[model samples]
Target: MSRPPLPPFTRDTAIQKVRMAEDAWNSRDPARVALAYTEDSRWRNRSEFVVGRAAIVAFLTRKWEKEHDYRLIKDLWAFDGNRIAVRFQYEWHDAAGQWHRSYGNEQWEFDDAGLMRRREASINDVAIRESERRFHWAAPGPRPADVAGLGDTPE
Candidate 1:
């Protein structure tokens, strides 16, 4: 049965979870990343909406497959009770060798258990030449940090 939508968007845990999600996406391993959500996490990414972990995996697989050299970096936007907003951009080369920089935003809702209950995203892409591209979608994180960009924390 379908359930009600999220109540509100505010919480510290949710913010941390969002950061973890950003880290996973920047990892570039969709398989590993998919595990973060509930087994039945519901998501609306751009135009496609998917449910369950298997679907999330499949969706990510197809996405990374066509969007080669995929690199994603997400920055914290805002936070509320159990939701967080994010602004992110990724650069990827399509199968036809066309490079695109996709700018997007997302609103994430979490259950009491802190697992993502719902996700809604919007994206728009702009084409760019290889030389003009900066975020090559290649990194352990978004950037090297020293250059004043986002990067993974040292463990």
Candidate 2:
């Protein structure tokens, strides 16, 4: 299977890839998200290490189960050859309804087929009041184009 806009990316292709990833993740559908990765993709998300698409599916299933109302946005940081880096922010409420905004960076290495073969992410979550939330788009869907990305605000 081939995922396109493959490799040695131009700036436009890299940005499109980032947006596609953001939209996939916002769907919160583990199976759907797993399609972006290779069958044997390796990932280190926070403190957990996961390998393979089956594991990726299980991990995301558990994540969305606990992180309710999850909304995410990923901004392209850089890209060269087969690698791309992204900075991201996501808002999610816990099962107990406590809100949080997570900040993170991810480095992704994709195969020539344009499927990510490796991903390493470092993330930190800050508890925030529900009123302090920035993402208000409908859940289980893509972020609307009108919503501003991380670049729109002072960093």
Best by TM-score: 2
Q: All candidates' TM-scores?
A: 0.79, 0.98
Task: Encode model 2's per-residue lDDT on 39-82: one tens digit a residue.
Answer: 99999999999999999999999999999999999999999999
> Model 1: how far is 55 from its true place, Å?
0.3
Best candidate, lDDT? 2
Stretches of candidate 2 exceeding 4 Å from the true structure: none
Report the Cα lDDT for candidate 1: 0.72
lDDT of 1 by residue, 36-76 (tens): 67778899998898998899889988888888877666766
- lDDT per model vs. reference: 0.72, 0.96
Candidate 1 deviant stretches above 4 angstroms: 1-15, 136-143, 147-155
Residue 31's lDDT within candidate 2 is 98
| Candidate 1: worst-modelled 10 consecutive residues by lDDT | 146-155
Q: Residue 140: error of model 1 in Å?
A: 6.1
| Residue 20, model 2, lDDT | 95
